[model samples]
Target: MDLIGHVRCFVAVAEERHFGRAAARLGMAQPPLSQRMQRLERELGVRLFDRSSRQVTITRSGALLLEEARALLDRSEEFLACATRIKDGQSGLLRAALPSGLARETVAAILADLHQHHPSVELELEELSTTDQLARLASHDLEVGLIHHPCDVAGLELGPVLRCELGVLLPRASLLAARDEVPLASLTGLGLVLFPRADAPAVYDDLLTTCARNGYTPDSLRHGQGDSFVHGLILSVNAVAFSPPDRGTAAGSPSSEVVWRPLAGAPLAWRYSVAWPHGRKDTAIHAFADAVPRALWNTAAVSTDPPPRPLHLRPASEYWL
Candidate 1:
């Protein structure tokens, strides 16, 4: 009775909950699978399963053991794969999704480094909204995501990689264009362009609350799905909006038709994070997460700022243009 064989049988039975199904999955006879389990119980001096005529269930000990077993198996596989890759002198692929708000050139710079250093490794990039990034990560559609903070999605973990202050984006010819920055209160009477609730409910709510605290409700002229669309709306109308500070390109080329002024009176800032499924303990995920901040460091525009204080503590000077 190999110890590893018994461990596999135990995990199979725990997951399938039926000896016959577990044996089928393991490509063995039911009697041998049952014997393996019984031998395991004898060795451990505990019953791992509760079997009735109608159904089979795992005992409390079995449930706990299952977690440890799975972790052990995952590590073993990872070790073998890493060894194989190193022997072959080849790495694997990293699939990632990113939110549009992150500076595009910053992402490009990171990808360039990965490509140059590990030519054998491949990266697949997708442009998704923050909400889409969250959903895809949970469903395993993406291994890692670059996203905004304040995500409430279950079964996901986040770490802040970079922070940017939100600034007002207005048309150059708009009445608010003369100032370097405008306070939230000054925009109370103005129509605003905001992200659609479906695409970014958290951002939308934050904007609403920020305005409400300033004693005004913004009149939304349109709701957009992404920054490109939002910029389009700004160009077409007198509507104003807020965005991260790295809104310009790497060369600091400003938008000709638009003027971005720091938001006055308690500035609002957004934290961009590296997010993945909580259950995912893959090497690739860890590598990508570790690489993100370093990648940002390679590009000077992206900075890791301390989390901003509560909207109230932010002074008018912080929002200066």
Candidate 2:
């Protein structure tokens, strides 16, 4: 019977008090509109209007049904609005995890842009390591992750690696600090602070392979568990640690005791990427992916050389950034 359509026809007739006027308002012929109202009354088993040759008037049953009919139309509109919002990634929450190792400014820029673009997307952020981000993401605890490694997890996929060149951070009082740029081989026998290989195997191994490739191998490797501890280790006057050049200077200030020097003839890098669970399609995920800027894809500011092995990339063209 197209129940809602019939009810709307009846409501129009009741309001207009004339079938001719109601049909004109509904943009339909008077005969078809009259038939629709008659069909609605038959379905409800009640007379909805008192029809006379002069005018039309609503019955008690029609008055009672009109209030419910209006509420139903309002609810239908509200439902459509909510469904459209979900499809467009406009009104849901996205739980995203980021690594503590990402350049602070890099993280800040990404977050700021996300807020501006997807303001309705409630962001619940967590600072996790790359390994932890992958695990939590797999379990569905997180919708998106900004991780620095493990780009090849079984259930995860990503776009081009966000690569950043590595530089040596040292005490300003040390001999190595005097150089504008330090060669990879020059730090071979010095006390070097590094991430424990067990913490991030692929990333840590890549750095080691870079050192060995340049004909230099650290004689002393102080495996620091965290960046704060590693930075403190490098501050001890002898130990040197690798970091991205603009890392600590993101706020435009360098530490008085620490000086940063670029690595010569080397391609030490921090390779990171945006990753998510495979086959998990969600609008918030799509919005987050698109919000990330194109500039972040290449953080390799100092080195013209490539990684020992090219980073694996899966282009995200279908997502429409």
> Which candidate number maximizes TM-score?
2
Where is model 2 more than 4 Å wrong at Cα?
1-72, 196-199, 223-228, 250-255, 280-283, 295-321
Return the TM-score for each candidate structure. 0.61, 0.71
Judged by whole-model lDDT over C-alpha atoms, candidate 1 comes out at: 0.70
Per-residue C-alpha lDDT of model 1 across residues 1-321, encoded as one tens digit per residue: 587778888989998999999999999999988888999999988889999987889999989899887887778778899778744435666678776666666787767766666666667788787789878877788878877655555677665557566778877777777886687777765667766667656655665666677665666557764666777787776577776666633212354777677777545766567888886665566656766777766553456765443112222221111
CA lDDT of 37 in candidate 2?
83
lDDT of 2: 0.70
Per-candidate Cα RMSD to the true structure, in Å, reads: 14.7, 7.3
lDDT score at residue 62, model 2, on the 0-100 scale: 83
Error of 2 at 307 (Å): 10
Model 2 pairs in collision: none
lDDT of 2 at 116: 79
Pairs clashing within candidate 1: none
Please provide, for model 2 over 1-321, each residue's C-alpha lDDT reduced to its tens digit, 9 standing for 90 to 100.
677677677778888999999999999999999888878778889998899899888889888988888788778778889878776667667788766656655667677777777777788888877767777888889878776653456687664455677788777777877787889888866777776555555666666666776866766778764666776777763678888777645321354676778888546777666677888566677666655534354332523223334454333212110
